[model samples]
Target: MKVSEKWRKVLRRQPRYWIAIIFLSLLILLALFAPLIPIDPNQTDVANMSAGPSLQHIFGTDEIGRDYFIRVVYGGRISLMVGVLAMLASTIIGTLVGLISGYFGGWVDNVLMRFVDILSSIPWLVLVIVLSVLLKPGLVTIIFVIGCFSWMNIARLIRAETLSAKEREYVVYAQFIGEKHSKIIRRHIFPAVLSTLIVAATGSISGAIMTESALSFLGIGIQPPVASWGSLLQNAQSSLQQAPYMAILPGLFIILTVYSFNSLGNFLRDVTLVEG
Candidate 1:
């Protein structure tokens, strides 16, 4: 069956796929239009500091009386951007390294796999923290650091898949047809890898978000004045006793977003397995 047809069939069988897509889409839309939305995330009113949720501010005001709702909304943009861009970076790097290692065996495979193994052995969070210390904490640094650490799993997964796929009848047939190595890998192998990559990308998004948030919470991520969910939570930490909602609001959003991505990734992985 065509991949698209199989994908459609799988999606039809899983209601959560639609739910996840819809929820994530709404989040992306909200983030995309956040700037245009008539809400002042930064405008503070000391008079309203520590206020509870009201009709005017459904999420209430922070310690400094900035509209919590707008801050959260803007925070979503940073969180989502970090997650997506990091996922892309990791996926591309991992996919290429895996494809190369698997498609061409011998020393290439040995060296690459050894490097991956060494990376995989390290404590992921610790490694990220160290990297964060070495490089200045910013959007780009967070994205690249998270991606660099995250790619090991993807590399191993793709490498195994490629090793198995290279010996398949279709691949052998392509080889027999005198196709160039690159063409065979791109045309035949890549399609198979693409399915797994989609699942990996989705999973990576959740991880990236979590990693970025954790770093930001530790004051090594998106800096002050930038409203990432992590930074928002950090800002609220001291005020937790006075304004419990300060911590709860952004935390809830982070949990929900991560859960949504994880659910979507699992659904895609299951569907891809069935397709295979």
Candidate 2:
């Protein structure tokens, strides 16, 4: 079937998936093109402090008189970037670790799986908070902390998928032909598990975004002068009664973005299970 037809079929089968896809796409586009807009997120207007939404300021001016709309737009850029990069980092680490452990099995599997278990035993938020406190707070540090610690689940998932994939006919044939381990994994095992990986990765994006937001909300993720959805919420807390929209707008975006990714992930998981 043509790719377009396949998408149509999938959308027809699960109509709500279109909502998730469209919302996510629009958010991504807005974040990407925010630079083309002329508004400065941090530029303050002394006369407009805590202004309500109006024609001049759709989202209104923040406590310090900064444009709330532009700040939210720029904040999306930060939030989305963290989500995507963190997902990529976790996926790569998880895939490699899972592949090696599953393919080699025996002692290698025992060691790696045990390590994963140990990490999993720790409360993720506590660990992230401790690390955030120890290290300097910034975008790169936040991403590194989230990406490194968040891979345990993905590794477990990929390992299980790889174990089954390696037992498949094509994988057995490749082994019989003396194919290199890496080549066999790349060509056979990886492809077999790709759908599962994609689903896990999609879910991971929302997790990462939430993690970033939580850390920022606690005043440990992205610092001042730089706006993020979470940091915006932190800033709006003092003036919440005066300008509730300041808190509401960013919180709404965060909820919707996370929900959209989760919806898409659920749809992918359902489709992949059916295909399998």
Candidate 3:
């Protein structure tokens, strides 16, 4: 069957996936096109401080009277960007390490796998907190720190997949045909492991977002004046009783976005397993 037909069948079988797709699509579109919305997220109104949701401000004005709606939308841009870029960074590093270790085996595998084990043994949150504290807190720093720490699991998964792929008939034939190790890996092993990578990377995006949120909530992720869903929640702490929506709105977005990605990742994993 055609790929589109297969996807439609899956959607029919799992209607909840539709909700996940729609919500994620809307979030990405809003974040990408936020500049066209005409509202300055930081444009505050002293007179309208702490105003509740109204015709003028849909989600309400924040403690400083900035449009909460625009802030949330803009914040999505930052959060999503960090998630995607960090995932890319992790995926690249993981794939490269896994490819090398799996294809070469022997001493290369031992060295790389041992390094991965050492890194994996460290407490993730403690490591992230230490790195965030040591480095200057910003988007790039958060992305780099999360990416560097997040790749070990992906590396293990890809390594296992690559180990299997390298022993397959096609890979053996490629080797027999005098194909370069790099060519064999790129053409044969990488494609075989691509499905696993897709599922892992999908999950990684949500993980990165949640990590960024947690760090920001702790005041070490995204800094002030810059609005992120997490940072917005941080700023809302003082006004939680006075304006519960301040906390609710950003928290709700974080929950929904994370859930949507996770659901979508599960869906993708199922599809990949079926195909395999």
Model 2 residue runs over 4 Å out of place are 273-276
lDDT of 1 by residue, 177-209 (tens): 888999988998888788888988999999999
Q: What TM-score do all the candidates reach, one by one?
A: 0.94, 0.97, 0.97
lDDT of 2 by residue, 1-276 (tens): 554565666788899998899999999999999999999888999999999999999999999899899999999999999999999999999999999999999999999999999999999999999999999999999999999999999999999999999999989999998999999989999998898999999999999999999999999999989889999999999998989999999999999999999999888776665531
Pull out the clashing pairs in model 2.
none
Number of backbone collisions per candidate, in order? 0, 0, 0
Q: What are the clashing pairs of model 1?
A: none
Q: Candidate 2, which ten residues in sequence have the lowest lDDT sum?
A: 267-276
After TM-score superposition, the amount by which residue 175's alpha carbon in candidate 2 deviates from its true location, in angstroms, is 1.2
Among all windows of ten consecutive residues in candidate 3, which has the lowest summed lDDT? 267-276
Residue 33 in model 3: shift from native, Å? 0.8
Candidate 1: minimum summed lDDT over ten consecutive residues — where?
A: 267-276
